[model samples]
Target: MTDVTLSVPQLHEWELMRAGAYGRALRYELPGDDPHRPSLLVRDTAPGSTLTLLDTEATPIARVRVDGSRTEPEGTWVGGVVEPLREPATPTFPELRPVETGELVAQATLLLGRRHGRLDGTVIVVDTGDAHAVSQTVRGLRHDQVDLRLLPEPAAAHLEGAARTELLVHLASVVFASTVHVIRGEAPAPGDGLVVLFTGLSGSGKSTVARQLTRRLRAETSQRVTLLDGDQVRSMLSSGLGFSRADRELNVRRIGWVASQIAAHGGIAICAPIAPYDSMRQEVRAMAERVGRFILVHVATPLEVCEARDRKGMYAKARAGEIKEFTGISDPYEEPADADIVIGRDDADAETITDRVYRLVMGGPEPDYAI
Candidate 1:
């Protein structure tokens, strides 16, 4: 495979991964002894599209690239030396220093505004060697009402399909006020795309309702639907978590991160977690609101009915003291004081329940069942 070297002043530590962890190590060459210095060389290995980080010494320390399967970074092949990148000099951003130019662009914009009045005319230019990064930066600035436009690099055009989809989150999270010209047309406005949160007890059929709702949305509408079911997320995103309150909250947060990504990209995220705490659910709601719309659906199936519907024998086990901290049995399932939609345990079919959720997602009239 052919390798092309590109020079870069700095790279975000979270952008590169090593054995499932981020923050790559770097070695300085003889003349470049100042670790705080900004520029470095990147060796782009073709055929696999891997980006290798070479220090001033020209020694390979780390290799990174956007993983096609995930919006987050993955581990890379590399040596063991690590160093921090130099902070960019932004005279305007004294309160909020400019860091690496990427997805968190809007966050930096907000920080700057909070410390130094409203940023009505602040212009932020981002060149991260990727068009998606530029699009995301523009969108983030727009979200903060920052006036800006993207200056696209010729080499960064013609991104792959997966890379394009991955960049949509950045674009969605940032740009809304100003226009950005892309090979694929303009950045989409953060539309009515909502994070529909379904919170209930362990046996409350929350996951089942979410799955049905997802299917209905996919079949009936042209919009994309991503379902983050509790059990499945526990296996993948929250694999190491135990059933403790703190661990459970962390699990919900992980799910929130994924849902936020989906919501930011103008898609519907149906999350069905046995979220027993209202505070944690509120946290997830805030996360979604930063990028798109948020809706909470409380599956109000009673405890007795839920226990009766528990096919996994979880309720029985919890009652027998085998399972500790089981919601509705041992742990408390805090009901939402204010829910957008409440699904009561009645003879209503799955279609009826799904229709109710779809209505809420589409901003339809408030259902009679809402509390």
Candidate 2:
């Protein structure tokens, strides 16, 4: 079978990639990032092929159909939003653009041959999904050179974790970079429990849901559960921190750190923090994923609804200019774009929401909750 590869920039993309792996049952070890902030996968879809987005429990949340030419990403989906691919990716990926490889191949061979004392044997350069273009380049480069075999490496969707990394590194080594001093580590053992992180606006019932979920999990399941409420965390773990974005991120990270530790020991870490940024939420997700499973439950109560539920009158104060840097008022609260489970005030009752969360945690069937 030919291998296929796609660069995953987010947690949802990674998850989708894993789900679409050959046989649909293979596993991969997720990487770790800042425990200081909280955090958070995808797949390559062939033209005319459909890809479904699922949660950690393998429950379908949405579906996307690949459209347009194979080289370009264009799709339409039902149920939720999926980010379109961005060209000229990022600073770390300047070489990952969609230029014609005919010129690139000639340039690469000359440079690589010069550096590595002439290329020989079977050197495979993986070409993401532009296999035809890459293959043409390799064939062009190999003209009459029988001893030098430059093959276009196939898609590598079947490769798991370190193996996938190693292959990609090997591909880079053959063309642009070397894999010297690259240390490959073993995949960590899967933790027995999960860390359910509730992130959203203040008065979103994140704390309430987290506490109630903890209670339900303890009563219904044998897994140990721990609640890390935002108010308590701010007062204890982040007493001196102000409401600046950096400080808020740090506070969220502190909570993530503690939650990760708890999850590592096979305990459910239920955290409800007003984690207002996507980056921090992803940071926390990465931290916990390395040690245990991480589930992002977005208590997606709207700004108006949250304000109405605000018992502290913080929203009113913020509107009156008495409070500063208040999220959803003076400051922005970035919503989770790819949350595992999303609950809102109008969605269902507390009991129903808690039950849904419990089902997801236990790997049971997910309700048809529209993202």
User: What tens digits encode model 1's per-residue C-alpha lDDT throughout 1-371?
Assistant: 22222222232222222111122234322112332211222221112444454442344545444222111111112222333233222222222222234333333221111122234454534343332334555556667776553321111112435553333323323332223222233333444567989998877778878888898889987879999999899998899999988788778877987897787777889999988887678778866776678988998888988878889899999999999999898999889988888885686877788887888777799898643
TM-score of 2: 0.53
lDDT (Cα) of model 1? 0.57
Candidate 1: segments with Cα more than 4 A from true spot: 1-192
Instruction: Give the range of the ten consecutive residues with the poorest summed lDDT in model 2.
Output: 34-43
**Candidate 2 Cα lDDT to native:** 0.57
Mind giving the per-residue lDDT tens digits that candidate 2 earns over 1-371? Answer: 11122322333233223323112322222223311110112222332444454433334443444332223111211112232232222222233322223122322321121122234433433333222334444564466352232322223333456565554444434333333223222333466857889988988888877888898888987878989999999999999999987789779878997898788677999999999888788878877775678889888888988888889889999999998999988999888887888887475778778878878888887667643
